[model samples]
Target: MAEPVLAAELRQEAPIPLDLGFALHPGEVTALFGASGAGKTTVLRCLAGLYRPRTGRIRCGGETWFDSDADLWLPSHRRRIGLVFQDYALFPHMTAEANVAAALGHLPRAQRAARARALLALVHLQDFASRRPAELSGGQRQRVAVARALAREPEVLLLDEPFSALDRAVRVALYAEIEALRARLACPIVLVTHDFEEVARLADRVLVLEDGRIIAEGDVGAISARADLPIIAAAAEAGSVLDATLVETLAARRLSVLDTAAGRLVAPVIDAAPGARLRVRIPARDVILADRAPEGLSVHNALAGTVAAVEPRAGGLADLLVAVGAARLRAQVTEDAVSRLGLAPGRPVVALVKSVAVTRPGA
Candidate 1:
């Protein structure tokens, strides 16, 4: 891995005990994923210099931001970090342009306005420059907040549930916008969120926190496939994330065909052009296993694979990891089904997935 652009080792005792360490590489979006009160936000705060841990060291871009042993602390304003809060923290009276310009205090007065406008244009909000936060929709307001953060020319970007306030449709649109912005800004980005779907869509890596400590950390696909982990097992949306490319769009059929490492899949019409890369989420509950191909069925996807593992769960349910080509698909079935199908590691099986059940995260 390349040298980490941002690194931290934090330790605390009171008000949510925390003991964790992590590093972020340039151009990598690492998510602090966990449930409420799991200390995801607290860790983000410590990194942003908003809260100092009892004993910790924070370094970014080869500069020390905090060192408890030396009793040295760099205040939030001094740290070259851009933060987008859960709530759009824009001044109600200020227009979108003014809100973004407020962060350009470090630049010359004459250059601030132009720089702010450029930032807004980057987020595709150039026309809303004169609109105040109250006049803008939730998604528009969030975009303004993002534009303001970019005006700081930060070395690291921190997003704290920035899309939580938006509805599903708006959130999906913002997901695409953020993905575009991320490619342009090659800085390390840290996202604090509890939504697994959000993590699957936007995060390159994930650190699962429980009781203020990191319980698991890995690439999003690996973490999502760990049914043995409490967090993954308990999530109703437990599933596998596959990297796929849009092969073509069948407008007449109202479906899009995608090619994945596992196999070809047909899904509901997606809004992207052909050849676009996408992340597809296949919920475990939506997958069915069969010993051989079924003659007649409405299922659009039937991938042949070998069983990799079986994790029995409460209520006699079992989670199976089926390896298809280079990818894995997770399927949840009853223990009875597992026995009847003679399911076990190395057993050949066919995984059935419905066209409508296949979802593109944030779509």
Candidate 2:
């Protein structure tokens, strides 16, 4: 394994004013996640030898690519990196194959074409080699761009919104394609995108940025584990979020488990051995409350919890926060239901959840 294509700490002012830090290790995907002006693209450009950070050291695969203190900077073309821009940056006058072949600078024309053909084939575009950029769809053009980047056998791969120019379905499918490529290529990979969904789908580790400096950094679970208060208040959904440990298989073979905060509870059986992680957020509106524990009900898991707080919602619906030991939950229910159930702060009630509501990733 080699070091990252570039490793450096950047200090900048603009979209966000401050010193920002990041590192890209070989064989790992690092995502610069932020909003429109969060400086994600700026960071990518700096790593690609485009934007020069006033104070930082950058190296590519153990080779010094850029050193600000040493007054040594390499041009983007000399960096031996594959950069896929948001627009694909294909030469419209040339066919897809030519655009890819152009990256093989010193190779003979025929050898370059063969290298281009193989790279294009890797991206599933062998037949489209002759197609000009104008003749290709957005997705096809992006694939051509990827093929061109790989043509150099880059020591590092940098992508800026590679999927943003395509349709949703195409973006998702292409992401999987890129993920497959990532596994096969041993180079360091860096992607810049504001779309958290993209990060969730593709990133092994996510770095959250706000106001230029990194506010959070960790795997998906760590970032999402924070109470939705700040993010939820921003997202506009009311739900009690819980992280559970998978317990065991039930007789019915439906998913059974212990709620993160509440004690033992079972839902429909899930396909997992003991000790799998599940993240579930139960919406407040789904929970039905009764003064006395309901008996002989269809709901499998009912836990007693006290009302934590009440939040006013649209259309006379109330968002209730219930506390089960340390487990906090948000449920959306009608004010009438709140009144009928005699629910208030500190009132005891049962929280009902279906097994299917538990969300799982392909772990």
Candidate 3:
């Protein structure tokens, strides 16, 4: 684990002064996650010298950027912090190369152009370096911003919703570019996002915040299991995003049992058993409601439960969230069917699912 290159204690006032503290080390990506006003941006702004806390200290590597009590405060420019914004924020009138060159203004013109070219090439936009922001696509403009931010080669990188404006495919490709950049750079990255899926894809660790306070922090795997995580993401994607441990291998029958929220679910042929955690996705659409426990059904994972909530899904589909054991399993059924089955907030129901469908993630 690389030591943090960035550190801070946050405060926005009142009951939760956001007395939060977190650090980032070389090559580590720390995701700042929370609701709209959880102070995620405030934390980033403070680090960027845009927002100053009444009481807090910030350090990058061995240099102390700010010490409120000690009266040490470095102005924004002196901190050497690179920023990537939600909007690409490239100069529309200038060519990509010029925009990138501007970021290296402190350097001589020739050296600045050389660095800009290198940064563009790093983002695979070398050929488009001369094009103005207006001539480029959304993704292209974003790459220019990234190149510009890197042109300065700061000690730390702070990105506030960098992928927000782009389409999914574009955002994903850009995020991959960032991950590659993360591998090559030594600077600690503080990425603020409201999307857990993005966090799962990009962050090494997550800082879960609410109401300008740090409520929880952990790896993506642990936080995905939280009941609320799924609601942010769709029920289909939420469940539990696990790396899946392989505990046992049943060679004779070519099957394995996975210890999951559905309890010891027997999975297909695998080299895991008992203690191994298997990656599985229980789609809300795949889960079905039953009135009673059938003796021998086609489905294997059956959970006896009571209807927790019956909510509307798009296109007349309804989500029947049932509380099974210690976890809530979501099933999508027609609203009419729910009405016909007399399924309501407190009605008894069984969640049925096929084990074969619970394959490995992306499998």
Highest-TM-score candidate: 1
Clashing pairs in 3: 3-25, 4-24, 4-25, 5-24, 245-277, 247-273, 247-276, 248-272, 248-273
Candidate 3: residue 19 Cα off by (Å): 2.3
**What lDDT would each prediction earn against the true structure?**
0.89, 0.73, 0.75
Instruction: Give the worst 10-residue stretch by lDDT in candidate 2.
Output: 227-236
Which candidate has the highest lDDT of all? 1
> Mind giving the per-residue lDDT tens digits that candidate 1 earns over 1-363?
899998899999887799999999989899999889999999989988889889989999989999999999999999999999989889999999999999999999999999999999999999999999999999999999999988888999999999998899999899888888888998988999989888888989999999889999998878888877877777768889887888998999988998888889999888888878778888998999999999879788899999999999889999999998888788999999999999999999999986433344332
Model 1, residue 150: distance off in Å is 0.7
Q: Please give the lDDT score at residue 200 for candidate 3.
A: 66
List ranges where model 2 is wrong by over 4 Å. 1-5, 14-18, 228-363
lDDT of 3 by residue, 297-325 (tens): 77767778888777676677676667666
TM accuracy, model 2: 0.71
Q: List the residue pairs that clash in candidate 1.
A: none
* Residue pairs in candidate 2 whose N, alpha carbon or C atoms collide under 3 angstroms: 240-330, 254-268, 254-269, 255-268, 255-269, 255-270, 284-331, 284-332, 285-331, 285-332
Judged by whole-model lDDT over C-alpha atoms, candidate 3 comes out at 0.75
Which candidate do you rate higher for lDDT, 1 or 3? 1
- At residue 271, give the lDDT of candidate 1: 84
